[model samples]
Target: MNLHLHGDAIPEGLSRRARSFVASHGVRADATPLEPYRERWLALGVPGEVIDRAVAYQERWGGLVLPPAPVYECGPRYLYADVPEPSHGGGWWFVGGEPRASVAFSFMIGPNGEFGLWGDTWAPLHASVEGWVESLALTHHASQWAKQVTRLHGDEVEGLSLDDFEPVEEVQGIVDTWWRGSDSLVALHNGEAECFSGRVRRVALVYSGLDKWGLHGQ
Candidate 1:
């Protein structure tokens, strides 16, 4: 399937907020500038399919200096897809990154062409770059719409009430995951917070108020 359609999968309002967030805190580049990098990857023997998805993402949603929502309370992060290089995995290629500096992980295209993060290990964050963007957008949406927003940290994240919530598969998180409920969406993150912190710093944002399009769209 074409994974690039994530931009269309999320609710329009959420996407708008995501764009606004990026505009305020990030730098977006015209995808056309990626043509040279695409040619370079091809010459480097990167698989055609891998290059396809990565190129599409860079062209569309790629950016730089993007920090996660303040609610996340994680380290500084950004989306910078400069050039492609072979990853430790045979067919994957280093494409970008989510976090920065010491705890940072490079973004890559997985064997099956999935958008992923490669740190000390590899973890697929989403099916596509736009999926990651959707997760970011939903963060703002859920936080604003929920009747009550709850922030859980460390082991407290384990006690979160996720009994009736459903996984948000489109976002396709490995360390990070999103859940939807009758009136809420829970965003659980283990990236820089839990996994890399060397401590149980897991975090979860529970957004509870989807009485309208939030529930209906999905």
Candidate 2:
């Protein structure tokens, strides 16, 4: 897996949009380290590996919102993780977003570091916090590199063919998905849709006619 350079918490694999997001919208002050929450998390029996990931995530992208849309033309689209709360039904813990789902005002993270909702849906959007950041960055930059961008909604999203495309390991999809091909890329935004409304359950982006650099998402 690709990582950020020395001293920079943001991953180098992430897109310029993701960087700008932290720059423009992130809180000016650095949030307190997750080390303080270590004991509490351990008390919940959260795996040591998962706790390490969360602490690392806090240092890297904790306060910054994880936008659902690739091209973010709006604010407060997704909620970033915050302090953990035991006030949850399942084994999941409240990490970010709210119960209402308007934004990251309240959301939950699974024992394995999956970013998700815990209410009626109880679904994870990304396999892990790292996956969410990588996927968001991919969507923002990949769209600009493509020759064409296609948006799919409703049943149409499931109709598309991804013959040669493979799952982008950077994003381990749970409710959402990302696929890559020789000349194209696909991003599904069911995470946001499911949290907002469980009705349609279809939101995909197809970036085709990509150049060599676009294919790799430089």
Local distance difference test values of all predictions, in order: 0.60, 0.62
Could you tell me which residue pairs clash in candidate 1? 96-107
Q: State the lDDT of candidate 2 residue by residue for 1-218, as single tens digits.
A: 22222326444544454455444433422345787877887887765666676676566654454434442223234344554544344443546532322443235667667876554455687776656666766766686688899888778887888887898776778887888898889987776456556553567889899877887744
What clash count goes with each model? 1, 8
Which segments of model 1 are wrong by more than 4 Å?
Answer: 1-27, 30-32, 37-49, 64-67, 70-80, 97-102, 193-200, 213-218
Q: Candidate 2: which stretches are off by over 4 Å?
A: 1-6, 11-29, 32-57, 65-68, 71-83, 86-90, 97-105, 192-198
lDDT of 2 at 207: 89
**Residue 136 C-alpha lDDT in model 1:** 70
| lDDT string, candidate 1, 141-190, tens digits | 66556678877887788777777878886576766788888877888777
Query: By TM-score, how accurate is candidate 2?
Result: 0.67
